[model samples]
Target: MAGSGDAAKEYIAGSAAGVAQVVVGHPFDTVKVKLQAHNTKAHRKLYKNASHCTSRILVEEGIRGLYKGASSSFVGIALESSLFFGTYAHAKQLLQGKYEDGKPQLQVIIPSAACSGALISCILTPTELIKCRMQVQGKDAMHATWYSSPLDCAVKTLQSEGVRGIFRGGLATLFREAIGNAFFFCSYEYSRYWMHSYTDSPRFAGNSNLILAKDVGIGIISGGISGMAFWTTTLPLDVAKTIIQTDPSPLSSRNPLRVLSMVYRRAGLAGCYAGLGPTLARAFPANAAAIVAWEYSAKVLGIRGS
Candidate 1:
């Protein structure tokens, strides 16, 4: 089991990594959410694709517009990541028992990841609801009441829908996080194992002197692969969650299946992946940076291993 010190280090590292991820990835995330929640019939279809979304935001709303809801995202990510990494570390330590050296086997890692993902979903649901709502506000003429900031959005949601409003899409978030993170953590651990054990990749070869560089490199590779795996597993559920979070009607937002069915009726299977392009585009680089930061920070703080 990890000592108290190790747990503290893991939390700090995860929070730091979350900050880095939010700073680099929030813009792409904004675009992705906007596209997913956008309604072609309701709006004029301002953006043709991910690239078009980027250009439109740049031209019309300037740099600030692309970073909508960044403040809430930053805090939410920090808390969620801290809890996730810390929980994963604790779970792994417990599952691995007396520690037989090397890695802790896939069986232990996978369950640990699932536990962490489920736990993080509690925080992620509310955070994402606010962020998505803020992101799509200006996209439609009907939602023209501009939220001055994340705080404003939170206050409005609370006043309008009570505490339940904050957790609008909690079930969908739980499903996505549990299933997606299982694949994500497995892919990352397996990728790192392959790089070090099979490929004899210099980036992950056993060398204490190069541990920092190796951890960061391994993290980048693992994170990229995990991002792809995560999105692939959970995109459809994610679409359901986004629709629920962004729907103006309280009744509509409560039923994820109904929203998903609406998406299918409106655009079929393709509609279920409305923002796939932007999401995949962001997934690799964003997750790469996030994991790199996470691993490197952990190492610097004296928490070691994959």
Candidate 2:
């Protein structure tokens, strides 16, 4: 009964934190997606850089443009975060049971996070496909008619391409989520563990009672590092995923690796990281706030991190 109650609390906390993360992060994400999907070789490039994209979005579409696909992102993130944190908690518990001291090492935590990430990727692919399609619209007349909103995008995709339409970038998403999250969770847990050791704080010494301020601070640091690690490790896959998801033509979206190869051939290595600036800019603060929000909310709900 107690374990079930704690799990419920953790789920709620994760959902709230996910909403908070999307609110803080979506604008930057919009810019990043646009830039990643932009065709630089065009006679008139849509955006020269991250700042240019931001300014153009402001001038052309107003503030609302910055949050074009926020509704979809909100829903997607809320579901993803709830599943991720809840799964991680349960996986940690299972690992603890396996260990003699009832405290799993980083090896256990890493695989747990990886598996959770893979599971979440199943849902995330379609969610992001809809969101990215909506976001790329409104940038120009060519794309403006592509989608009226996230819902319209999803509906159109269903009608045009069937159920498989929504999962355009599932392979890339799976790879990115699984591999990237492995690094992200490992970095976060290792950083927190190091902080506990370095500070020698009793609160961080055990899993039961962590100091709120210290934990939040460490979460911020860990989140930033993890964000960088994720992006660095999976930027190419992410770029491919974005391109595949945002492509308007049904036939063009068939092979992510083919698209990636074309991108590499056309633009070289740099092409694989088109929107890196905006992505990195968004990753740190956004993830920091998200991790802090998740940890803080969990604490408020009487769910301690193991």
Candidate 3:
């Protein structure tokens, strides 16, 4: 009974932390995506660096520009992370309770996170679509005069492509979130453990580190490495997803390799990674801070996220 209760608490706490992540880091996410996927031509080669990109966006679009699609992103992150971490926390509890031969198995970890991520994909797709359209609104508005606002985009999608249009890039989004988040949390947990064990830092995984002058540096390093890995793995899919979301048409092919070949032919290798640098820079800090905040929040709520 105690164990089950612990699990339930953890699940609830995870959702709380997820909410924390979105509130703190979403604007950076907005700028990152817009700089990459905006359908603009004047700012085609917009920011020469991550800082430049953000500054340019603010200068051109104002503070609200920095927060474009914020509400949608908030909704998407809140829903997705709630489902994601809630399921993941509960699944971990269930797996721990069901131990193989009375011992927890390490192999099931990946599967648990995978299942959590898949469910989150469904919850996230529509709102994320709204967020995407809003973020990319400023990208050379000439070619993307299709929708007046995020709502219009949603309406147009429903009108033209039906349910699938609203979720035009859902499959890729699913793969991105499921695989990306599975690895994200999994990597985060493992890295935190190794850091706690190896480093001499006080407060290896939380904002509480400020109190300890911490050396839990591994979390940052591990997060960066993992972020890079996850992004690289799904980058091709991301490219495809972006194309489907932003381009005038849905991708006819699902094969990752074929999409790459086509993208290369049409947009070139540079196009494949059109907005990669900002993405990584943005992703690394946003994700790392999110993970740290999430894990710490769970602990504060008396739930063991790991």
Candidate 4:
């Protein structure tokens, strides 16, 4: 009973952090999505050089065009991050059942993190699909006419694809969420722990000002590490997801592994990482700002890191 109550509180904090992150960090995400979703040549032109792309977007689309799908991204990320944090904290608690003295044991932390990652993937699939489509922004795709506002996208996807459409390329997203998220929590907690001890007592379990700085710092560093992890481990899957999301055709019911191999054959290594620079750049501040929001959100929930 007591554990349940604590979980409720933690979820609140997590959700709050997510909301704050959307408010502060979404514009960068907007740019990243544009870069990722652009119809660049897979091995050659998919991602125009960052400077060239930025300049082109500004000159052609104006500032508004650069932020085309921002509304959808903001909404999607808010819900996604909130659910992610809420689940992550509780999952950690569940995995690390009481120690002999009755506290989170911390032994099963990684799996806990993984579970949270997986859960958030399911929750965010619908919004994520919409956001990804909007970010890429092509008129040729079948989904081009489906959205007006964020809600419109969600509704249209539901109506057309049933529950499944909402999860277009969800398998890839699932893998990305689970794997990338695993790295996120692990890096965040471990970093905080390291900062706390800097020597031995790893585990950021107390202190005020230090906790604030540590949480913010942890978020920044962990976000970057998580980005690297996703970039490396799931770049191929991301390529598939991006392709399917933007392509005019539906995700064939074929095995994802098979699909990935096809993409690899067609595009090769360079195709897989078309827009890595902007991705890493966005990951840094988006994550840093999100973490900053998480810390303040924790205080709002009456659980200041200290």
Candidate 5:
């Protein structure tokens, strides 16, 4: 069993990473969600592209519009990341049992990451549902009553659709997280190793020093690349998830695969990856910050064993 102390440290580190991720990425995320949800209708198309969408938000809603659903995101990511990193640490420890060596093989890392992702989905689904709803709504006066706040969104959702409604796209979230995280951790680990090897630096894995520029750079590159890897592979599912969560029609299918099929029929493959541009843009910096924060916080807490 992993020590409670170690688990607590992992949670703290992950929380730091989560905060960093959201602060850096939420604006991009808002744009991505909006693009994914609104671009489906040809007759009612909102924005032509990412830049246009961004400019409109800035002009109409200002910088604050870029972070429209940030409150739910902050809370969701913090809690989900804490549970994910903490769980992954313990799961990897158990899987690696007595190894006490360099990086564990992909076999160990994959299952550990998958398990952590699956568990965190329970927490992630509801919060993401709220965030997506808030993000998809425009700043128009007609939409003012949609959700006054995250709490109000939750209350209204509960009143209208009940508990199951809060977790509308949970199945897609499950597959996305479980599969995406396996890729995420694997890519991160390998990228970190490659960076360490290429630079001939020992600090990439673990460092006793309080701070090092090289180490932070390595973390940024590795985390950013890994994030891109995660989204590139799972974006279709994400598109499905967004549609499922935001569609106002009571008759819209809640099934992710079905949603994807529906989108495929309407707009073909490109439609399924509606928000690819902004997602990739957000993934790099957001995940870079997350890894840098996670590593530094872990070192400070004395929990990074490498």
Candidate 6:
């Protein structure tokens, strides 16, 4: 009962983080996907930049346009985050063995985070496939007749492609999540550690209010920077993932490296980083909200870090 209770709390905290992340980041993500979908030389470029993309979406679809696949994202991110944090929490503890009191070793954190990411990729792949398709649907005249909603998109995809179609970009997603999350967790943990070391003092240990405020601030900063690191290093893989998932051609190669090569040949190196602007812009704030929500909720639920 005690173990299950802890797990439940971890899931709840993670779910809170996920919801906050989607609510804050979905608009930025929509723009990023739009940019990636049309960055190829094979298609005429649509928007000039992130600002242009934002205005175009507004003119065409209103404020709701920026949130095209939000419904699916809310569900997807919530479940993904729940499992992610829970799995990481448990994995870190297991890897810690008997020395559970100290800061986790880099070796321990890396593999644990990687495992969490790989596990969640199973959920993220399908969710992102729906999201990318929905985002790119009405971006051009050729694709102006968009699916009515995420459900419609999923149903139509199932009708045309089957379960395999739904998981079309599984390999790309797996690589992105596994690699990106390793950097993410490592950067976050190290950031927090350094920040705490630089600022923390034993004198303030008794002041719970001050400690709470400091912790939140650090979490926000650490999470934001970590998010940027994740995207900066992995955006190419993400661009490849988006193309693989959204390409209408059934025969399009699902291999990420091959897709990247195709992108490079068509649009040069710049093509591989299609949505660098909005992705970096969204990374900090979205991830900041996520970490803060996760840490705060965990504190509230009395779920201590391993």
Name the top lDDT candidate: 6
User: Residue by residue across 1-306, what tens digits does model 2's lDDT show?
Assistant: 238889898788888778877988899999988888885333445677899999989999999999988999899999999998888778877776666553237768888888889999998999999888877876464552467778888898899889988898999999899899888888887887787667655555555444656777788898888888888888889889998887777777556678778888877777878888888888888888888888888877877753
lDDT of 3 at 238: 75
Q: What TM-score, computed on C-alpha atoms, does each candidate reach?
A: 0.91, 0.91, 0.78, 0.80, 0.93, 0.95
State the displacement of the C-alpha of residue 280, model 4, in Å, after optimal TM-score superposition.
0.7
Which candidate leads the pack in TM-score? 6
C-alpha lDDT values of all predictions: 0.82, 0.82, 0.65, 0.62, 0.89, 0.90
The residue ranges of model 4 lying beyond 4 angstroms of the native Cα positions read: 1-5, 23-28, 35-47, 98-107, 138-146, 199-215, 251-255
RMSD of each predicted structure:
2.6, 3.1, 4.5, 4.1, 2.5, 2.0
Clashing pairs in 2: none
lDDT for model 6: 0.90
Relative to the true structure, candidate 2 reaches a TM of 0.91
Residue-level lDDT of model 6, residues 145-213, one tens digit each, is: 368889998998898889999999899999998999999999998888889888878866778888888
Candidate 6 Cα errors over 4 Å, as ranges: 98-101, 139-141
Q: List model 3 lDDT by residue over 92-181, tens digit each.
A: 766776665423345556778788878887877777777777676664563434566667777887886688767767787788877876
Count of clashing pairs, candidate 2: 0
Please identify which of the two predictions, 1 or 4, would achieve the higher TM-score against the true structure: 1
Worst lDDT run of 10 residues, candidate 4, spans 97-106
| lDDT by residue for model 1 (51-145), tens | 89888877878888889889899999999989987888788888888556676487788889999999999999999998998888664434634
Q: How accurate is candidate 1 locally (lDDT)?
A: 0.82
Best-to-worst ranking by TM-score: 6, 5, 1, 2, 4, 3
Candidate 4 global TM-score: 0.80
Candidate 3 has what TM-score? Answer: 0.78
